[model samples]
Target: MDLINTCFEMCDYIEQNGVVRLAGNVKLRDNLKKELLHFLIYISMTDGRYGEEEKAFIKKKLGFDVSASMAADIKNRNMLGAGYITRVPETFKYFILANAGHKIKNDRYDNKEARTLAETYRKLGQEYLAANTGSTEVEINVLSSYCVMLDENLKSYGLLRPDYKSVAIQAETADEKEPDADELIAELNSLTGLTAVKEDVNALINLLKVQKMREQMGMKQTSVNKHLVFMGNPGTGKTTVARLLARIYKAIGAISKGHLVEVDRSGLVCGYIGQTASKTAEVIESALGGVLFIDEAYTLTNGKGQGDFGQEAVDTLLKGMEDHRDDLVVIVAGYTELMEEFLDSNPGLRSRFNKFINFEDYTAEEEVEILINNCKKQEYMLSRDALEEARRFFTERVANKPEGYANARDVRNYLEKAISNQASRIVGLKDVDKNILAMLEKEDLVGIEL
Candidate 1:
């Protein structure tokens, strides 16, 4: 059977199970249930081997306590059997028909939801290879490709699709091989002033090399722990690092694709009731096989009372994290205290994200380096005296300012203003000499002075 059809079958069975109803007569949308079941199956088959580990992972994902009876039932059924088998019952035929009914009847199917269901379906079908299906065989690689199609179908609903390309689903090609060292170095050079941050990221690159080697050796490599939290003040290169990390992740095969999709409060949240989950799920769908960076993620819990849409966003985000664990890497960035509150607000959030990279406030010397780098990019040369003056000005006026206002961003603003001021001093003068240029200066740095 095609993977999409198999996914529908699994969804139907899962939704009909007695345990499914135990969550109460809660109106679980058919689309949502189908997508959730699809994710459960995907994580279980992570190593391309479906066994006890897959079952345990499924149970956790579905929020089920694996009882003895549940264990016995899974064993009897062909759910987690090794290799592929096509013994799915005829009764399961209703699922495919029912799913098809929605499309045939009105054609009012939300492609967003359909795409999500499709993704889950494609993943399940790809992972669970039947033991032996004769000479007319289906390959897991082919099935993974189908999942990408569904991802595109679902993404048609978004306002503007991201520019990054999705990785091809070919088992002949392994994801996460060693990246070109030169490319990695070029990217590192583009970033500035965070020596420690650069080193940490390089370490992750080396780790990926080791992981790729293990995969080549036929050893069960430890799952790449891709989860990370960026703890830092603003403009300290957290987001830049995240974008680079996505490329590295793709290069090393942590996810299927290495795109960077950014969203803050506006993307995943909704003010109305019953809408946040769908909204969040849609965002997750777009970010599959990529990095989903949530800047100021702590603000997602703002506002007073249960009516706050922020909480819904959080709930929705956590759900997506669990469902799309194998396909995406989420990086939440915000100030230290706010991030603390964010972690405290959700147990699942705290548990899944274990790696934290702290971005410290830049020192005076580092701030000077940053300004010089910015100056070079802007094609402006600051005289030695002007540069020293700008650095001293920033030290007194920006960095020493109050906690909420101090950051590398503030330093950049200072440099921009100084450049502007120096430019303004050199109006319509055709042949400005080096001596005249050397004397350029700014009355004050950019941004409000302390």
Candidate 2:
């Protein structure tokens, strides 16, 4: 292409997704990564063919590879994890510019992505120019224009992204190593719409840190209570944040292990006579040196018959707390009003689980983001029209504020239904491309009312 056309293409991207559109946008960051991969392909597919050698080259350099048939398509549009992108140093703007199943986000995000390509092109283009006597000036213009466009793209990507913030999170894989203290803290920050929870957790961490410092210097330590009361509707990340706190506790030397054990009323209480203490004791023993998260804890005390052994479980649990005061961190969770009543049921309970953190229902935007993230975890995307429908769906859901709404859990269930509809739409199709297979259209949501 001529310099005029080249400049036009470069200028077009600036306008398509400049500062306004690119700022703090997951979609645009993805676009930049896709463009980067395409640029890699542009230079590698010298004869316009994606061969095994080219594929191997990509696999060898990058941490991921694609099937032979998918070499050029699926590999080009892969989305790298946010941890890979945003975990780099401040010097690296940490943009997500490739999805090709490769681990390359720790790479420099400033100008290296463009400059490396430019240099490679310079070498390859020089060879071609030497053979064909092509215009050196044209090559110069091409590299210069690409570099300028890349800088602009990065600038826009950097506009709203300060240093590194959380990317919409996904489930951690089993093989992925556990995150350390700082990493756990970063993960907490990465969770969407947990502003108050994050603040409380940070404050607690800071206080623990200070207390540790004071004790080391032989100063008298202030009274501290790590046991917590988490009051929230279903699926508001009470368990998730509690798990992080457990790991954080271990990382900071507050606990011997960083594991999280979760249970509910049934996990504790028993129907057999005089067996509740033994059952609850086993559960407590398993959670020693870590965090034991109790969900719907109010059931243990609030609506029980006289024959019930819920009181035995409670007495056993309180004794365990006192016995393991140096290690065990108990976190009781349930709805706001019921949890308050649960605390009032026993004087011992009110004294131990004193700190309360409320988990609010997600707003419309956070719910939609959660929906999109859920799709990503399953290797799916939503069409622009579909996304608009989702935004509207969630907005209406939030406005109506449905009774018995399970915040994040509700979003996940809705996505499951949406994808089922997507499957039905594509089931009869003869061929499905990368884009077609991954996308859920607005029609998939049609007649699926709130």
Candidate 3:
């Protein structure tokens, strides 16, 4: 049945039963009734035809007159947690008046609904009442019990929403914690020392904007950024960017859901024959609405023989990426050379990851900045002379630290330990003063002996 007829039927059922107890045979339908009541009220109030019918319907269904006096007790004046009355809470005063107004405006009625609507508005305050108005088809039954905690008392009571805007009001009440894309990008830029990578990220943002515009215009062409490869050394912020990409995907409605699922070889290839594909496919399903970032993805090709699960994982990954091409974004990260070899193992991999962003090793100057930033992060003091000494030491070390040296990471670790040692030496000097600690000079730099 259409929504209005269905609502009238539910209203009739509730009136005859006095409780509309949604427990047994018609439980699902009863649940549907509870969920869709507010929407029905909205429709009933649209032109005031169904108001008196709704009141009589509600009086029979709920066994109570949904009067203005009762609305005052439930309406939250402070706007702290009042708007949509769901299930049993009679807080939605607007719904009550709108219902009354609709009934009074009916051609079959003898009186006007203005007095009732006006009286309810005066008691509830029109500004406060207006803010809580929402759409007609809101389904409160679908709302989680936790979501309706403010009106938990109504779980057993069939209440009318005095406010017609319950759905929108509840949405506004929900905590909006998702980070804005620009703010996250700015934060990411501040965290990483990779200038070229940041510039590429900015370009990606622009591309997302274009993608968004196309989506808004009802253009359904496949997205331009389906596959991406993050070619970078360890600790270069590849995973961080992938996380932001998930949010960007959500903002543009490219995916039904948006979340970032990060895993490596262990999460994909299980140690069994014919099992790896299913395992990897399951992981992809979980990441359907967001980004799936595979760190050290080269390891997925580590098996020596044809019987290995590694090849199976690789095959599964290739297929899964295609199957979920419309919604999922897969980013594989590893050392640049190894990643190239990995792509070469299966021709499909090479064809799939068409875009790559290489993360170059940090320069000596960048490494120094990384060390200072690390110090600041840990609340350590690095005096000007000490900073210069540390920078010079790292520059010399980088020149001779061998090919596999940890680069910026090693510098950060070394600086962190040096500053920790300095702090330990001065720990007992509680009254030594913050200024003196702040002014710690080159001599204060802990040597290798510490």
Candidate 4:
């Protein structure tokens, strides 16, 4: 049967079985039916050639034979101005899947072909929506999945481009809908410390924006390499800054998805020789269209000798960074000296990460501010004396023993200790009120060594 007739039969089945509540307006139902036919035609002609396999599959599943002339006419009419399908009804999607399943039933339901057809229909539905809305505003992660599926299924058969640009249009549209440049800048400025780090990130974001603008204006533009190296002490907000940078990159269309996937050497390197590369690749695969953040990244190179699997992980990671350069951002972070040595260890690493952002340890005042923020979040108010004690403690701790100070992390630990002390001190207070419960006094902050 032809696609239109198959759609009609499916609609009838849906109505008869009460599979979906039909719209009260007869015209609305009719329009949806027409849209379904348009969608099938579009998918059939997407690659510019409707083959015998597709026709035979349709006939076997829909239970009617369709001629080549009829398929060609549908393709031509759709090209002329049949209009694209915007929103596909859930019932119709299920129906298409069910039909595809039926066609493969005699073949023991080849799982691979079923998955390919299912994903093809899924992408077709999304592409139709993107075309109808004149905006490619679909989620980039979803679009990336579609592209992966297309590469696996259609690229092998010469039915789709290996670059997957047709599927990527949806992500580019979503990138266009990113938050405004000024808003993202404002967010960067709103951070508590990391003054130098903020400036570097802002400059990178501005450079990306200009490059994107130039591309839009038909001017020559250079590709911006986004992989970065972060050198800083623990608890100095390297991870926090990396997250914000991911969002900024996405906002400027430098990346598709802005999510941050944080990992360390343990997550990528395996104990076995060949396992490390596969493990690293799996991690990178999950981080496509997003940022892959390797914290304490220097540890990946700590293993000695050529027998170490860490090098295998690094090689795999470098290749992934190169392969997915357009959609992926990699940030390696660790202590200043250690990260430098790690980068020096791998000749390929230094060139790929041209941008470096140094996160400075927070000042005593900044540490106090962090503590205050933590206290506020936990519904605990520091008394004036307690606040003074905290400031004095941090001042002495930072000045006297500055070498291994954990910055904001130390502050958090201090606050947690004080809260514990407060609970211990109040355990005997049966008559405690809200005021006492919410307050952290001087005694609570005293004698807590950094």
The most accurate candidate by TM-score is 2
Q: State each model's C-alpha RMSD to the native.
A: 22.2, 19.6, 20.6, 18.5
Clashes of each: 8, 4, 19, 2
Question: What's the true lDDT of residue 310 in model 1?
Answer: 85
- Candidate 2 residue spans exceeding 4 A from truth: 1-177
Q: Which candidate leads in lDDT?
A: 4
lDDT of 1 by residue, 375-397 (tens): 65555567666776777766774
Off by over 4 Å in 3: 1-176, 219-222, 256-258, 304-306, 401-403, 430-450
Writing each residue's lDDT as its tens digit, candidate 2 over 179-199 gives 555445555655667667766
- Candidate 3 lDDT over 1-450, as tens digits, reads 333344344344433443333335454344433333343343234332333444454454434464433323222241212234233323222223333344323322123222222222122121111122231212112121212232222111222121111222233333855544433443434443555565555445444544455455565423466567888777566776676667656665666666788999889888777788899989998999788899999888866476678888888888888888888888899998889888988899988888787777677777776666666555566788988877777777667766556666676567656766667777787688766665545765546421
lDDT scores in order: 0.57, 0.64, 0.54, 0.65
TM-score of 4: 0.59
Candidate 4 residue-wise lDDT at 343 = 90
Which sections of candidate 1 miss by over 4 Å?
Answer: 1-182, 432-450
* Candidate 4 local Cα displacement, residue 297, angstroms: 1.3
